[model samples]
Target: MFSKIRKAYQLFKSIDFEQLDKLSRKVDLPKVMDSFSKLDEKQLNGLMKMLEGGKPKRELPPINGDFYELHLRLSEEDRALQLKVRDFMEREIRPLVNHYWLRDEFPFEIIPKLAQLNICGLTYEGYGCAGRSSLMEGIIAMEIARVDASVATFFGVQSGLAMGSIYLCGSDAQKQEWLPAMQQMKLIGAFGLTEPEVGSGAAGGLTVTARKTEKGWVLNGQKKWIGNATFADVTVIWAKDVDDGEVKGFLVRKGTPGFEVEKIKGKMALRIVQNGLITLTDCTVDESDRLQHAHSFKDTAKVLQLTRAGVAWMAVGCARGAYENALDYTRKRKQFGKPIASFQLIQNHLVEMLSNLTAMQTLVYRLSELQDADMLRDEHASLAKVFCTLRTRDIVSQAREVMGGNGILLEYDVARFLADAEAIYSYEGTKEINSLIVGRSITGFSAFV
Candidate 1:
């Protein structure tokens, strides 16, 4: 007993007195030492264990899909902006997602906070836009969808489809009028392209008709699945020119005499996105409101081409959200007195999910690189869309599978991602449609016809 005390005393002496004094100023070191000095060998062990009980529990590293550390490749400025968007999504979007999705309601309350992020027109050059790289834009898209696909879809329509239309096809005067306010999100925007009878072939064939008049152009058509149309301040309505038999775009403002919008309801997926059925019965748009640079369907295709890569990134986000949630659940959920994550089968599912997720991340990283380099093509974006959305469906399925019955519950979050994946798979462009686009590129034959 004396020997043990001597050894403990020697160890105490080894700690410098000055260091101890400094520590004493911050903590009750003398009291702690006195308490330890009173303990016998077994008592010391017991006291040590008790002290440890007050210490923070060991925490596991967060589950992330970026196994290759793709985020590190971004420049410091870009990386900081990426984290800002991610923080916004986590803080603003995540909490409200399940609630809004369940009620089929849009959270108008989030708009001002969202605008504060200054990410609305992320990649545009002029106006109040960030004028960031395509890579940064893709990263932002992934971050948004990581929390909620519905929110991501709404954002994509506003920033990518709507704003991109103006940036790519609107004249200098038109851009000056809309881009600044839209960039600040003071003026919300929507893109109207797909009509009731015209969807996949919207590029060449649109049922929406546009007639020239001295006053302006008269637009008559029905647009279906037009996201954000119900409340958008400006909706870019695309119509076929009656005289030239070519597609043209018109900036149709809200409350236009013949413009009508009905909120599309009873949706099973992405319910938070306010899709609308817009009817234009002789909706007269001023000639000045027309997208002057938009001469043909080809001009409209440019806008879709720019935004399609973003859809692919959004798929990666959906899969990542589902995978991470499932992984967390498996680690905590016990079976046979052990965590399910310990089971070989559950680990297999995790590995598969991670593999698909990594593939998607790398693919989109390259896709955005191509975009930034101005070497991106329609087929490049389409391939990524086809691959990522397909893999996301599988990843979300595995996420659900690992969770057993709880996976289907909205509280689990995996169910929403799974349901949203179906919408992503079909929207923008279906698998078969995008596949044919790629097929034509490789074979040098127009298989789409």
Candidate 2:
């Protein structure tokens, strides 16, 4: 009897006295206590657990941005490489970007690490390149931009604009001299074409002039908004030949006499990329250094068309990163009792963002397929660039809207993506120019000022 009384007392101590008192008013408290005293040890434990609400709520699966499982389409090897690049960006690039972006400086330390990947000149046939498909190259561009878009811009300038100029246009000797080193990233390159005055009018009216000289070609003009020019070992300078009245490309080495570059500052987007304003007063290039095949503006346009496709891929990365981050944020943040994501409006915003992102992804994938098949045209690339970048702006804006106060904070990362999306939208080609290119193809009209 004493043992029974001790067991009952122990069980009574475990119960919430307040709850017991409330129950006493509604039921036979003595009867409940008597029943608890009769329960075995295991049964007592089960009762306590039930009252404590120890059963966990259902857990959801992780949030993955790949809604349509496009990765399933990749072969085993291609998907492995894609994940490798994605991991590298997340581990190495993510931690350094916000710091460099705030100060408006490039993270020069990452160059050696990037070289280790051996991904530069990925699609070109030789010169120590991977010789991968355009799909792989576009995947890499997307991965790099997923962490930070400024890094993507810097890479596109080097791998696409600069090296592509040499690969497509440089002679055999020039290729042997530069391609291997540039592919290994032992030598960095830049593209110099846009000018302070002549931007959209570069094809017909390039102010930069390459005049024939007894020594070589003397290039005289200013090239503005040239990425990597400040530190690039070689810069591909496109100039109008005064003699032939045609545009030509020259490989102007860094520190060449009469070649000067000053870094452009005070940018709100892609701050980590070093854009330079180049001033050339009689900058001379040897006959051998000139890109052999780049004899006209048409050659330059080819390089632009190819790189424009890469920019479209990069824009998709920026949107996906923002959407993923915002989605996770909504799930964690709460306003009343449940996660804000539980609200109907929040789900609508996320679904809208996912819809746009999936469309951009599928479109770029097909764009790369066309490129691999060699069916890509100027209009095809321009349409992708126009559509992707424009959609990216809308996606990032919605991402920021969901985060409210936290969205603008750089720590949240959407802020940087937002700014960099602006740069991508403007660069490669402006929305108006790209749209006109598509418009001209469809309607057979050339409307330009």
Candidate 3:
């Protein structure tokens, strides 16, 4: 009798108390328990299993911002890496961005942890890189920008612009000397191609002059708005050859004589990027320091071609982040005794933002596909850049509009997006420039003056 009693006690102890309490509110628990107690061991086990089966299976919430479920297209490994990067960005970069942006400082402390992720130089082969697909790299760019545009820009300069210059144009010796440490994040890099006067016409118009002599190449000119230059270990400087009038690249090491970098101040957007105004007055680089394969502006364009797609991806991320935050804010912010999200006009703004964001995401996905297939033309990436950044401006504007007055506040996050979108619109290539690139491609006419 005692053994049976103990067994019954054990079974009763295993009951879900909260569920029982819920059942008690709707039914007579005492009667239910009395009936339940009469079941023998086998019957009780079956009954428990039946009760468990009646409960609903827990469903996972859908991933936000992937409105078209595009992530399902990624390979399993690629998807896992994407999620890992997303998790890191959410946990490490998101919370700290506004503070750094306000201070206009880079969180140099995050480098070690970020380096541990082993994501830098993601699409490059060997030299400690993952050698992943261009599509995966684009996805990573999107994830980083979704947290902070400055972080994404900084990473783009390092991974796409700086490292890509080396990978595509560097000699085997240069690649062996630089890429491994850079891929590990132990050595930071910068790309100096834009001049104070040569913004849109960087290809054939670089005024920075490089004179080749017996000693080496002497770089003389200024590069403005160079990201990561303030503290980068290496800065890739593009200059017009004094003799040939062709463009060439030089790896200008830090603290090289006459290579002076002054931090660009008073930036309204991408404040944490640490952009620099580089003044290279008779900066002498060894003959060996020149990019072996970069013989002309076309070679330099190859580097730009690789990075333009990343810029487009970053624009998409910025727009998506703003839309997601605005959507969440609307659901919680009350107006007219209900959520603002319930209003028709508010829905219109959200739909516009979402539709644009969705379009940007899909377009970049195809752009990256072209890149992975090695069929990506300059115009293809330019079209994506032109389309994504232009749509991002519209989407971010709608996101700000829906959030009302709170949208302008930095704490709300969309205001940052609002300002950052303007910068992204002009970077890599401006809308007019990119549009002209696409125009020349399809129509066989140069629209760019």
Choose 1 or 2, whichever is better by TM-score: 2
Q: How far is candidate 1 from the true structure (C-alpha RMSD, Å)?
A: 8.0
State each model's CA lDDT, in order.
0.91, 0.92, 0.91
Whole-structure CA lDDT of model 1? 0.91
Per-residue accuracy of model 3 over 1-449 as CA lDDT, tens digit each: 45444555665676598976876799886776666667687777666567568576556344378899999999999999999999999999888899999899999998888899899999999999998999999999999989889999999999989999999999999999999999999999999999999999997688999999888999899999999999999999999999989999999999999999999999899998999999999899998899999999899889999999999999999998998998888888998898898899998998888889999999999999999999999999999999999999998899899988998999989999999998999988888889899899899999766
User: Per-residue lDDT of 1-449 in model 1, one digit per residue for the tens?
Assistant: 56446645655675697887887799886676666677788876555456557476668778877888999999999889888988998888888789999999999888888889989888898799878899998998899999999999999999999999999989999999999998878888999998788889887779999999988999997999999998999999999999999989999998999999999999999999999999999899999999998999999989999999999999999999999999999999999998999999999999999999999999999999999999999999999999999999999999999999999999989999999999999889889999999999999888776
Model 2 per-residue lDDT tens digits across residues 179-283: 899988889999999999988788898999998888999999899999998899999999999999999999999889999999999999999999999999988
Task: Show where candidate 2 strays beyond 4 Å.
Answer: 1-55
* Alpha-carbon TM-score of each model against the true structure: 0.89, 0.90, 0.87
The list of candidate 1 runs beyond 4 A from truth reads: 1-43, 46-59
Error of model 1, residue 259, in angstroms: 0.4
